[model samples]
Target: DHTHLKKALVFTNSRTDAEETILEMRRMAAKRGERDVFHVHHGSISAMLREETEAALRQGPGPAVAAATLTLELGIDLGELERVLQLGAPYSCASFVQRLGRSGRRGDAASEMIFVTPEEEDEEAQLPARMPWTLLRAIAVIELYVREKWVEPLNVRQLPVGLLYHQTMSILKSMGEAEPEDLKEAVLSLPSFRGIDPADYDAFMEYMIGMGHIETMEEGTVLIGLAGEKIVNNFRFYAVFKDDEEHVVYNGTEEIGSITTVPPPGYCFTLAGKLWKIEEVDTRHKAVYVKSSRGKVDTLWLGAGGDVHTRIMAKIREVLGSTALYPYLAPSAAARLERARRLAKESGLLTSEVLPAGGDSMFILPWAGSRQFRTLERLLKNNLKGRLGLRSIVPMEPYYMVVAGRTDAETLQEEIIA
Candidate 1:
């Protein structure tokens, strides 16, 4: 049963998925009469718990596995891991490589990763539903990285005004007091601020002073003001992005974690890889009291999805169109791909870019990527809506555009070309 893999890391896309996966893992362990060795590590979880999980994986006597989001993607030593597992396709080849590098760290053993992608099967589902988008994405990511040695290119932020403000406040706080010219020089000398013009810097300083974030003395020196001091002294100041007002959770005397919303008493939720039943809600203090819970509960949390590159989208299209077999696919995955390919060919998706959907609807497949898809979507909704007598428009991004209207294919083509 591969018991030699005593330590492993399970990477997921979001915090909610990580928590849910660990909860399932604990359930499976409980059924086996084994110790619950699963833990969760994410940004929302307390740093102390995360560090403790890391230490447990490094030194715990028994088996240990941690389900985590991007919090564990970066460099953090957890000794030598025997396995690395991913729930679905990673956002990019760079992410794939980073997660893969975490395993098989002993001696000359090569790193390895296992991808566990789940696909739904429905007898009455549509053609698009049958297509294995996640599988295709995984193949594209792997082929692009392994065969072409190509990873998504980095795009540096052109305007980072928030970071500029943070750096300015931090420098002023450290310096206590600095001349106006000295402060400007100190903030602008950083490499991140090299593109900023002196005039722009001066304007930002004026704005800060106007907002009472900085104060000027008779000696022509600038110092952090009361407002700026309040911001700089907070523990959350180190984060570049704004965090939501969160309520802390406590399990009896032990601190658990924080969440954005607090449900009324008697709601069960999952946190830190364990279920918790809410006993009391202290709205004034913004603290939640909970005890251990065994019942299943569905909890929702806010998170952002990763952006798909145009290249990766094109690669997915290629995978869909081509008949080449991928050896990495399991038997079930291979069978799913075969079914999708058969259905795609029969539906004329391989030859025609436009297909009629029932009486008045049509699907326009541009075979383009995210940016191109966005442009086409805008054109249909904004420019050609009234001209085509369009009744409705549905956009499935980076894939196809479906519109129901009285216009025929010929006129639609003419309008789109024009």
Candidate 2:
């Protein structure tokens, strides 16, 4: 009831989803004869609109719900909240815990959270070698938090080149032209740029000059050149990563939402749990205007979302070793696990304790976290090859490898140690 829901925050994974959800909530509120008290907040939403929504939420009472992305996950104190709802699996455990902490502020008994994973039936789906085990992973994350309070450590080892480029332009724009040494010190001293090396900074300047992104005057002052000006002048240049070519979805004159990488005219796709047909494309302004329709097509980005945790991988191994049977193990999940077990046994990975899939140019399934896995990949690329005739290698996650040539396991092991 509206009386019970003093204030609620619903977290969605994407900007489009956030927009769609707020619309649905408002419609439901209208149906119940209640006030339209829902706010949408996401990156794509205009700053003025977001500010208005935030102000409304702060003014309390009357069951105001805010549908938001990661923008609201951080330390934006919303006073007391009745509950927080997560739409699906959060990208990480830290994010999940952060969202959960938003509720129960006003000394209420306990905060409440409802994690909902909207299901879809795919008839022609070929499942994994072991079911995703998302439930187990979620449980494990909670258990680990209770026992050891583990939060995944952030990796800042590699300097973010894209961020560096952004900061360079920002410094130039803010402080006007600056001397090369002074510019280097200004950037290197910043806390966020601590991972960046002074030498790399020098190389960056050279790259900028080569790419016509920056220029040095006769007076030896570094300034944002023509190319840099073109980039910085654009609103999209404020963001570090590349933005997808998206079109604005509108119902008449009202902007409903946005879609990424527009499809050809007359093509339809599902977005925000609704179908849309591209009506017009404004290539000059990089916007697509669309209208709503019915019928479903692949809409979600099939990009590599994120990496699985080492603990989760370890737990998957433990699941295989144990005799317990999970009731939710769908037929596909069961078959996949069996297949993995059979492969594991055939390769003598279980008993021998050897990294079973070994050859002169084999892939190593360390079950290590992404950072460690990447480190091993780099180490192998640097050390092996010329010494052992090992050529190309590609690592497929969980446990699979593609090797270049045929060589004995013992020799590979020796080379790995050396």
Candidate 3:
């Protein structure tokens, strides 16, 4: 708690983590007699609240902590922050570096980041649980940046059909009406839509027209239809990314933030680093009214995992294979890594791709990225299942897959080779 008074930005991977983490932080702050010190910021929150949180962090006379996701990771100037805290392993080295750059922006001060990797307490540990995956990943990311100056390359999406459609609707909505050729030129002139085929766009426009999203006048001009107008007129239409329907949470008349779902009356929920008891649910306006309450409540938010590069996975494998200890690791973390390395050595996982997992089960270490691992899984289940006598195939994703089959390790490996 030495840095409790230091202004910091606590980064989480998702909105749910941001909410929960802020709640926990607020609880701890309350014990220290701190009030209105913790704030929450994420995409789901209202723009006004997010701006307020940004302002709080940027020009605070006293220490104020903001628990946030990537929404606060880059772009905004939060002044000179004393520290950056990451809740879990960041998905990429680029992300790690971007977050690390948030601190120590003034003068010659060195940037500081404190990674908090939470370990699960399981009485009966599973094979995956035995290894410190999060710790290893955090180490690998740091090493990759420090040692090799390597960051995962950005993989830009090629065919952004959704963005294209969004732009089309926006253009039509703004221009009111235009000839098909003029509309085509206007939409396709944008750099993002440069790769899109004109013929394909025509086909898409025809489909949209048929679906009532656009209308064609007798004069051969195109305009936004009632359906498209409904979409274009909404505030959310500006965003091209997929957004889930969320209910706005309000403290009396003041808007707190938005969540994916609203609880019924008498239910308690968390938002913007504070707990509230649901007094009423406004279904028509998609809002929730609440009053300040104590204790704890968990709220659900939708999240998805990001893709891990094969290079990072290879670095993880190297970390497991080597005996070199990372200086940044604490004693407990070093001990945990030692145990994991010992297990890896004993199970021959470092050198071998296949390892025995108790009776009638074996592990296949693909050491590939998510997409590659999924492809290998399909190959095992669809193509190699019968040949290898595989009964059940379960994947832990982007890592090793466990399969329970009749065939032995040697036979399974040999069969896989064939």
Candidate 4:
């Protein structure tokens, strides 16, 4: 509505969310007589389109908004950015800092970021369902950064076995062929795979050869096998991360976005936020033709939910147990926090290890991180399966576990004590 709102970037955690935000923003702007001022920029977008978006922001007369994903997080020059909006608590401290740094570069003007997170919804008078974990996490991360400047370190795996397999085929294909000893030296030389031992590599190669990922030539050199060449020849094989099979989205000549699943024609779906009807789904081209339609639709992308860190988990527990009011919380957020604190106290989230769910299921609040939660799940599944008749051991990371099936409080106590 104001001319001062020249350029702003809203960052969402997923590509789908970015597109959805773009669609919604455009709709909202059009209502205010602003047209074609909102755009989406993500990796799935075409290079030319993305560059056009950058160009538009660089030389804008009126206001323009870009709903973006992490593609824009890495110091991309989107000119005269007056503000940054985080649609959720950033996945990490580093990301929070990166998104915040994108604004207010105009000579002594202050940079800004507005974090907008939804409070958990109430349903069925569910106990502890009212805990605003996302909000608590955002608070914890901000406080931790302010207090200790804590940031999650880069987690580099020692034995990147999956990557090693890909690299081995890629290297051998690029160089034509390499002997066993040569292959070992070449892969080990990579800093990413430096921790890999030659002995383990030998086993890997043997397995790959048996699996037809590699074939031994006459001079004891390994060449790409039938299975391997098919992969390396494709341009997509350059990336180390595996991708879900995607169908490219198109609106006339323009590509809107991509999705792993394809919905049929007249099946409503959302991208960039207005309704889009699938006009044509060309599986051969791996492209979907879409047309703008009426109504809203739910959008989803293929990806796993993020893992909760142990430090954040600990912080949430502390937040629950303490009465210290944070200055940063909004009115709704503060009220939600007060409600959650009360619920935690009454429901024994801080004081008791075991609580009862509505059914025969008993809830175990072991404030442990994912790994511990998973181990406990396995222990319950395998060790105590027959003895306790353990039906399910669901691992709700950073919170609690629900152990059900003919189990009582005494059984859980005895099992833990023993």
Residue 56 CA displacement from its true place in model 1, Å:
1.8
TM-score, predicted candidate 4 vs. hidden true structure: 0.82
Clashes in model 3: which pairs?
none
List the candidate 1 regions with Cα displacement exceeding 4 Å: 1-5, 159-240, 350-354, 364-418
Model 4 residue 294 CA deviation in Å: 1.1
Local accuracy of candidate 3 as per-residue lDDT tens digits, 254-343: 888887777789888777877889998888998888999987687766667667788888999999989997888879888888888888
Expressed as tens digits, the lDDT of each residue in 110-205 for candidate 1 is 877888889787867544556677787788888899889988888786657999999999898889999988888999899999989989999999
- List pairs with backbone clashes in candidate 1: none
- Residue 398 of model 2: what lDDT? 35
Point to the candidate with the largest lDDT.
3
Highest-scoring model, TM-score:
4
Question: Whole-model lDDT, candidate 3?
Answer: 0.84
lDDT of each: 0.83, 0.65, 0.84, 0.77
Misplaced by over 4 Å in model 2 are 1-88, 102-108, 111-128, 131-133, 154-180, 193-241, 307-363, 375-405, 408-418
Predicted candidate 4 versus true structure: per-residue lDDT over 180-260, tens digit per residue: 898788888999888887888899989989989799988888898998878888878887777678888888998776778
> Ranking under TM-score, best-scoring first?
4, 3, 1, 2
lDDT, candidate 1, equals 0.83
Q: What is the C-alpha RMSD of each candidate to the true structure, in Å?
A: 5.4, 7.0, 4.9, 3.9
| Window of ten residues with lowest summed lDDT in model 4 | 1-10
